[model samples]
Target: MALTDTAIKKLKPSDKCTATRPDKYSDMNGLQLWVRYTGVKSWVVAYRYQGKQQNISLGLYPFISLADARNETTKIRNDLAQGINPKDERQKAKQKDNLDFDHFAQIWFEHQQTRIKPHTFKRDKGVYYNHIKPLLGDKDIYTVRLPDIMAVHDRLALQGKTSTAHKVIADIGRIYDHAIIKGLAPNLANPIPRGIHKSLVEHKSKHYPRIKITELPKLLTDIDTSNSEPLTKFGFYVLCYTFVRTKELLGMTWQELDFDNCLWNIPANRMKNGLPHVVPLAPPVIEILQTIKSWHLHDEFVFFSNRGKDNVLSSNAFTVALKRMGYKDKMTGHGFRGLASTSLYEMQYNPQAIELQLSHVQGSKTVRAYNSANLLPARIKMVNDWANVVNEVKQGDFSTYKAKSTADGNEMAFISFLQSLRYKEQEIQDELDIHRMERLEVLAG
Candidate 1:
């Protein structure tokens, strides 16, 4: 029969000299009340773990109430469902260090400062504090199991933070890595299961919205008239003028700009490909930079956060503004890249120069090395030309937005025509008009 609180209070233990015996009554589920018949009793749970039968003493009865015993029994069963042995977990916890998970993770986070870029650290720190800490901060590193991590992932996934759920895989995974690295928990395994990210919900929404080249005029006019933050509005212009990734633009610092050289040098740590990228600024872009500088918005970064200088403008700044401008799903911050690529490809700028300027990774090692730095002149010309084309489009001057004609015998035009003829980059005729080559060099300079 099921035991109740009245019966549990009535329970009594039977005492003996050596291996004493107690009168036992099965309570709810796996819990049983043991009575010594001497007004003393306790609780014990019996279960199987790893092909062996195990009995664990819960605690003295009355102190561990009937409700507490039932709750703990359910918890143990849940842990077993995830292949976790509660007995083994308790054993590990006994061996665990005095420091909790958050304290150790904080130390690891600080140590990572010299190893990662500022923006990356900011993002990782957010994950650590917002997602992981609440659930696992006080958990002993050795006692934290796969169920704990899955709980964090499930919480994020349920809240529609699937991308953050995916990121959590690495966030907590590294904490265990550093713990092992520092010899803190030598026997502790990473509670996060490997290949666990495959099961997290994927971002199934439309990736980004873009406008056609024909629709460029409307996007430009709407941006100029946007009633958003001034910096946010200028962001659209910079996106149009430079076509770099939005994060790259948001993280733009005064230290990265070289006004005299008309260049925006992005360090390798901030770049996607881990290669330093240089963007040649057009006259329009230089003017925008000057306008932003006049605001004195930040001491270091161009896009300043209202919170503090260390914090940056929200990543959603443009997307939120776009929504307010009534473009909800019809436009996005990243759409600028697609628009620029479409315009340049149609304008007959060298494909190599366009791709290089877009910071695309080249397939061929030799070609990548040859194009990485060697395509700057073409990139500069392309930027200036595209910037002008955008300006003209904004002014409704479609007549001047014509493709460079290959039939015109202009040296660069001849070169572009020659490039169009090749299916793949192959050896071309070495013969060229000496006067045309000289003129081409002068024009390039």
Candidate 2:
């Protein structure tokens, strides 16, 4: 018999009640809600599970109208008719929706931001936004397969973005695995198949090309003396004097340097190792800083960018200068480090000193800590010698060059020897600083 309004009002407690329009009121029995005994009406559904009575609420009255309640209840009745437990089915569906690839990927990206370095995070974000998100943003977790990932790779290859496509695919696989571990998604299969990328695309080296140490002098001499920008010229000089990374030198500020003390304090954030490094200023480095100071004291950065309002100079400034000077292939901003390292070691400077200056990690747990003392005096001398050599080479004075072999059987005979010496000192000083810091920890403990 069809349920009427009068019948519903007359219905007493414990009376088994169901709407005649059960098909129209399916969700009411499936969904859980609330009701009160104070004549305050609410929607609820009663069901039996394994011979035990269970009651689930649909919602409150007025908000959930009679028509809507009937519709909800009818859906649950259809599920039950098919021998499906409406409650369990609804829970499974909710879980499946939450485990969708796009949903899990957003959560994965947020968690990854805290784990990687800032520069690395920036690169990953670029890959996500430009490649991965566009390709697989709407796809379901179960639907994504190896073919889909390979398709993305092929598309990127066609667009000349092979490297980025590979990275995006790899990142997607990682995000999927992360989701599976957190129980947000099912562990099905990694879409990125191994060897697929290697077979389809050619792998390219990421680092800048290293230049021959001997050719550095000729390269420096070839730079245009006339019509060269001061910052560009000064930046080259700084690169030659200090064997620091391009970003490190560009980020340098006047406050970090102590001219009277002959020291430059690079903060921890800028350093690759995330530790503060003190660079002992050689006379040439001091002179270069003074020269730049004479022109731009208003700006806090030692190397101010004329292109921007900030202290940082454009990254391409040095590269452009090299190109203009016709040394495009012969010398790069990073090649200066190689040039300095090789030259200094040839001059018989300590290997540890050179490695520390390059900021390379020493192979030991104890060596990596803050216990090392920075070899300030040795580094200062090495840098000063490097500056003298650079000046001589620039002025066309490599007449007294002699080739010599090191105790390790490595040959280090070249005009770039002094340039190498400056970097070697930096390396040694870094190790020493670590040792010193370790000692301090012991004392404090």
lDDT (CA) per prediction: 0.74, 0.65
lDDT of 1: 0.74
Every model's TM-score: 0.56, 0.63
RMSD for each of the candidates: 19.1, 19.1
lDDT of 2 by residue, 187-231 (tens): 666666666655768534343555544555566666536356777
Q: Which stretches of candidate 1 lie over 4 Å from their true place?
A: 1-107, 204-206, 225-235, 246-261, 266-275, 287-325, 345-352, 360-370, 395-445
Best by TM-score: 2
Model 2 scores a C-alpha lDDT of 0.65
lDDT of 1 by residue, 254-356 (tens): 9999999899999977788777889999999899889989988788899888763235677688888888877887778898886776456545668778777
Point out where model 2 deviates above 4 Å.
1-97, 158-162, 186-202, 207-213, 272-275, 309-311, 370-377, 399-445
